[model samples]
Target: MSTATDLAELTARVRAHLALRHPDSPIGDLKTLPGGHSGLTYSVTAGDARYVVKAVPPGQRPVGRNDVLRQARVLGALAGSAVPVPAVVASDDRQPAWFAMDFAAGEAVEPVLDAPEVPAGTARARMLEIASVLRRLHGTDIRTPGLGAPEPLDAAGELARWSRTLHAVPAELRPGGEELLTRLADALPSDGRQPVLLHGDFRLGNVLCAGERAVAVVDWEIWSVGDPRIDLGWFLLFTDHRNFPHLGRAVPGLPTEAELLDTYRDGRPPLPAMDWFRALGRMKMAAIMGHNLRRHREGKHHDPDQERLPPTIAAMIRTARDLLA
Candidate 1:
């Protein structure tokens, strides 16, 4: 799949698969779309319509995050809801499961984000809009994303889930992972907040924005029904320069964490144990970075972007410990 010939073959397969779905329509070439958290994302042109196809890699297992059908199912559930998500067009359950959704007309990165040459003004309003969107997303019926009874996880369970992944990475890169996990497990939330639909890796990066507004929330690979704070805390940390080093420190235009929380709360009861959730979120990011960093080093999946994540692994642990303190 590295050579031009291989890409052409894959493109043909994608075009053929989609042809059956739109039998009478003149299907066009599959243009490779770059930069997504997971799965193979491509933009296909068919007649006057444009579609984004999310598919599991050709030779990999389609379970867990690679399961494109799971993402599509959640998108289908949230399609007509208040949440802004690309409308699901179709899904296929064959080997290397894949799904199609209408291509969102927006940039994946927010203008106010920590990148250069990217416009930066709507940062405040856009941040609040994100909070409002989260409120609607969490309000979604948890059962809609489930195959059967949805298993809702709290702090300890969520930590355990990521622990399994961290174990696959090399030990040297994750010095404080064990201790952090222990601390998070011991200090589980006492209030027992109700679970809500969580965009497990929610952040400005996962949002698709049109000008100052978020038009769609993409990358549903790690979505789940879990404690709401898991999503909120991770998202908030990106705005804070002290945590999530990948976001850098140029985000002064964004709203403060307090402001974001107040906006998300709307009229509902105050969110409980957010500090602990934010700590857990850091730990989760550390695990993800460590695991992917290891994969990158091993040449299992070569992406130079991961080369810089090693520092973030340590930063995440430090931030988690500070939050826990």
Candidate 2:
């Protein structure tokens, strides 16, 4: 990762690389885009061509947080599929991994999901569009050699992973995370699901909507071959008032949990014990918030946005426990 002083040097490197790739077209405007947590995004233009450069953050990144190569591979695999994903242009695996892709031409409408003023019909349409896109993504064949074979379901292993994450959090901030982990493990769903490609962090925030269509589903860092229900569970958790108090309100026209589930399950088998998955999702989020807050408190990372996460963590833990109840 390049230091602040070396940002221009990094840009220059990008310019030089693009120049070689397009010998007839010299690089033009280059600017860093914002709003991502794990990596940096830059809007680059060469002559008449425009693209997005996704790069790892300046410093070391935690596991599963930043995987530029994996993201590029997934995008490449989705080429010609129904899933709306940016086309990969180039990828570099050297230190401070980075890749370039076509700039998705739409606005991310996560914020719009909470706007009470938006018309009910418009809101409902947007929510359904999100579900539709997820359906396409999950429907993608995971057996493709490039995407690799689906990993066998390991409910116990999944529980253990979240448990480790919870234990790593500062006990003072999340005393109940461990207990919730135990309860979740004990009640882990035994009936296995057919493995599908899960957009692990699917939600409004990760989608860019154009009218009633999902232009693209960005942010593929945590994507994997897993139970498709996990994605549904995570999506519902994000919008559930019991979890994200600030952003979970039911907006006008926005599809209810039942509607979203219905849309997702249209042609698939019935989903089971969704509340359990929701509980696990909340637990996972709480642990992640705890970890992020821990990082901020230690002066390891300074992010003002994280200041509000402590309350979120508490809400998440309480929500997870209540779901168990």
Best by lDDT: 1
lDDT of 1 by residue, 232-277 (tens): 9788876666564654556556678888999999977778788888
How accurate locally, in lDDT, is each candidate?
0.77, 0.76
User: By summed lDDT, which 10 consecutive residues of candidate 1 come out lowest?
Assistant: 110-119
lDDT of 1: 0.77
lDDT of 2 at 244: 61
Question: In model 1, which runs have C-alpha deviations exceeding 4 angstroms?
Answer: 2-25, 110-117, 145-149, 245-247
Clashing pairs in 2: 124-253
> Could you give me the TM-score of model 1 versus the true structure?
0.88
The true-versus-predicted C-alpha distance at residue 314 of model 2, in Å, is 2.5
